[model samples]
Target: MRNHYLVIFILGLLLSGCVTVQLPGGKVTSAKDVEYKQPAGAFKEIASADADKSWISANTGNTISYFSECGGKSEPTLKDLENDAFAALNESKTLSSEEVNYNERAARQSRASGKLDGVPVELALIVFQKNGCNYTLTYGGLAKSFSAEAAAFEEFKNNFKAP
Candidate 1:
């Protein structure tokens, strides 16, 4: 059992490898190099990465649509991502109520939240120049669960990385 545990641990590290990220600000660093807490527990379901390296993410507490796609385009400006985020959220029934904005600090990412078909939803988007990709984390749940979903999504943004 001890030997097996050791092997598993080593493999885990190997699998994670060295995660490098290039923020929109042109700062290149590894995932471990960044200081952010990835939300735990809330996000439980994870699917395999597809051709574009996109996958679905789920919260342990609720069933909603959440996904992340890494790749394509090199524009890492927060403004660019913010526009994209807003457009995506436009599909929601409550776009008029959302306050979409860009975060200039800490990687200069874009975040937005609002309701869709009576359900609340939030999004976190970022661009990684090093990885040559832009990714988004979209989560939706009950109106009452908006706070929780936002918190969990924030955790994910706080710990987000690329390359």
Candidate 2:
């Protein structure tokens, strides 16, 4: 009947709407897999040697890591960096929470622990920022299985050069 044909057509249209085309390899692409290119000449290196000196002085006696990337220029002070790092660690639901303290000198101390490879390890990360520069010195344990992270941080700091 005409009604039956209309019903069949409507059903076919609805089913076609839900159909998804699979790629030749049966792989589904996700939006997150898309690559984004960094804008050219985006990051400039800090020019002052004194900035590096300040970072080194503030981060003594701690294993720290340094990473610099070409990005925005909203330079944060040592206090701001310390506070931000602490806030990030505090907000992590995976780690066991603990009290953290920071001094006026922009020194930080905290203890936290979490699972690593089915084993438990304690972690301590300290941060120091100096002279309101773009650099932040961070010392932390990735896991209790390894030793101090300060040496790695020192190596990273030593590699800083004005671009």
In candidate 2, what are the lDDT values of residues 1-163, reduced to their tens digit? 3433233222212211212234354442211221222111212222232122112111111222332222323444444443444433322322333333332343444444433333333333444433332233333333432244334534443443322
- Each candidate's TM vs. the true structure? 0.43, 0.30
Whole-model lDDT per candidate: 0.37, 0.32
Model 2 error, position 121 (Å): 7.2
Candidate 1 segments whose C-alpha is farther than 4 A from its true place? 1-39, 48-77, 91-106, 118-120, 124-128
Which regions of candidate 2 deviate over 4 angstroms?
1-75, 91-133, 137-139, 146-149
Candidate 1 clashes between residue pairs 3 or more apart in a chain or in different chains: 42-60
Error of 1 at 145 (Å): 1.0
Tens digit of per-residue lDDT, candidate 1, span 30-120: 2222333444554544332211122222332332222233442245464444454455343443232223332232343444555443334
How many clashes in each candidate? 1, 5
- Which 10-residue span in candidate 2 carries the lowest summed lDDT? 53-62
